[model samples]
Target chain A: GAWLGTAAAPHERPGARRGAEMKKLYGTDAAKIQAMEAALQLSFDRNCDRKQPKYWPVIPLRL
Target chain B: TSISASSKPGADPASLQTEQRARSMMRERFLRCLISMANKKIQFHMYEKVKVDATFGASDIDVLNFQVSDLQTPIGVQTEALIRCQDVISYSFDM
Candidate 1:
């Protein structure tokens, strides 16, 4: 009921939508997959924040 | 649904569950492998036969980019860098 025509619908939230998609894709093990992805993403974000790593080459190699 | 191309359009529910479980197991194992690679020396093979080594850090959830440290390039060693996954043809590291 709260979601009806609401601006902050569940689908509007990327994280919530991702979790829902994972559930549809992974079924009973969605939580486990989601946890792994979250941890991996967290480490990437933390490293980028702390290291301030720049992209090498400064240009796309493939395109 | 975003089911794989191989999945039949009107597949039964039980078979769909089986397929999803299989996919989850495969993805979980792949993620575990990526986790184990952290801090290890990884050699990335790129186009034009260019190769470089870096201490593995972490990859984005989408696997589009890899954040690494001490990247050994042709010119000099970069203290830290992010490699676009699209540029990489393959990568390997010791267990």
Candidate 2:
């Protein structure tokens, strides 16, 4: 039987697989931090009774 | 790590104070995160494609180790375990 292959098997490379895995596993640090902030919004401090109590706000950096 | 910025030589006092404020804020957020994770089932993603689940108990101030319960490892389930923070790349749990 005759078969055909793509021009370049990019996915076959180890580096490509690792790159794809990393992309799937973790997001950009900034985005991850944003998601963490969102999650924290829903969580209450163990010492607190309210849903979102008085928590210190993270100061924004100038640069 | 806790704080990355160190006041540079000849840096203005005002900027140094600002940097300290930022550091405290970040540390506070991280502490709050730890508190929220207490008693929650967390899934840890480690290096070499390893993943494990455990009930988070507590972590030291330095965050070098984590005290967990019912740690599900490849060998067997441990009643109580101390996981090295370095071994974990990331961990998460729903609120």
Candidate 3:
């Protein structure tokens, strides 16, 4: 079998190992993340979008 | 006119003012979230088990739609696209 070529194990790649660990951590936090979303999305309903009105009211601007 | 808490009837004026302040803060946080998402690779989960990856641009003020670039769809890669928020079940991205 061609299994003993490298000096180190497969997990020796730091970048790939860190990425895999992050994905696992994120999976466990899914429920907490959903709760956080509920808290943050309270004011973002459909009718909340707004922009400044273009009227005749004048406001001072500092230089 | 903005959607303030004052629209509700039978509510005390002081409490309505407090609620409007909280709502403004929550909205500001959400806007910050949107700003952080700019120019990132996002995975959008649509209906019917469809998932696509794209670079997120800006979303409309109402959040009704999101503008993306280099969207990798099933058919082909679109140079630019607008994804309706109603069609998206969820989206995720790595910081």
Candidate 4:
């Protein structure tokens, strides 16, 4: 009954939440840090897409 | 995230700003180091005493995965592979 009564907030955006967190963590340099992260992420995504790299060892090495 | 612990509750704005700036500087330096590793041969030391070498390609924003080329594993050489950061204990590259 408690689960049915509570509605999930649909207005919250994950990207916006991460931006706010970055601002809180980096203060004035949040934009710069965000930019660098964005660029690195883009490259990683592009390389993975083009190369289709599979995970080595085929299993968790630590766990 | 470690720096957040240093900022005590009810701390002054100036001190909080200083802490945040320090975190930013450290993170920026780390990111720059990753960027410099691109196209360089990196030696990764993993758990279970597994050591491998690969040409660094790119790393995810979260630093959770590293995309590399020509990964030399115990079995054989992998043309391209994605290495989980969790598996890697430490990685080194020449300047």
CAPRI rating of model 3: incorrect
Best first by TM-score, ranked: 4, 1, 2, 3
DockQ (0 to 1) for model 3: 0.01
Candidate topping DockQ: 1
| Structure candidate 2, residue pairs in collision | none
On the 0 to 100 scale, the lDDT of residue B55 in model 2 is 86
Q: Report the C-alpha lDDT of model 2 over B1-95, residue by residue, as the tens digit.
A: 69665544224556545544554457458867886888999998876677889887766544555767778877777766667767778999999
lDDT of 3 by residue, B1-95 (tens): 76643343124555545543554456457767886887899998876677889887667545666767678877777766667776778999998
Clashing pairs in 1: none
- Minimum summed lDDT over a 10-residue window in model 4 chain B is located at B1-10
What is candidate 4's lDDT per residue for A1-63, written digit by digit as tens? 422221121123335436666776678999999999899989999999999999987997987
Clashes of each: 0, 0, 0, 0
Candidate closer to the true structure by lDDT (higher is better), 1 or 4: 1
Give the range where candidate 3 chain A is weakest over 10 consecutive residues by summed lDDT: A54-63
Cα-based lDDT at residue B83, candidate 1: 95
Span of 10 residues, lowest total lDDT, candidate 2 chain A: A54-63
**Top model by lDDT, which number?**
1
The segments of candidate 1 whose C-alpha lies over 4 angstroms from its true place after superposition are A1-17, B1-10
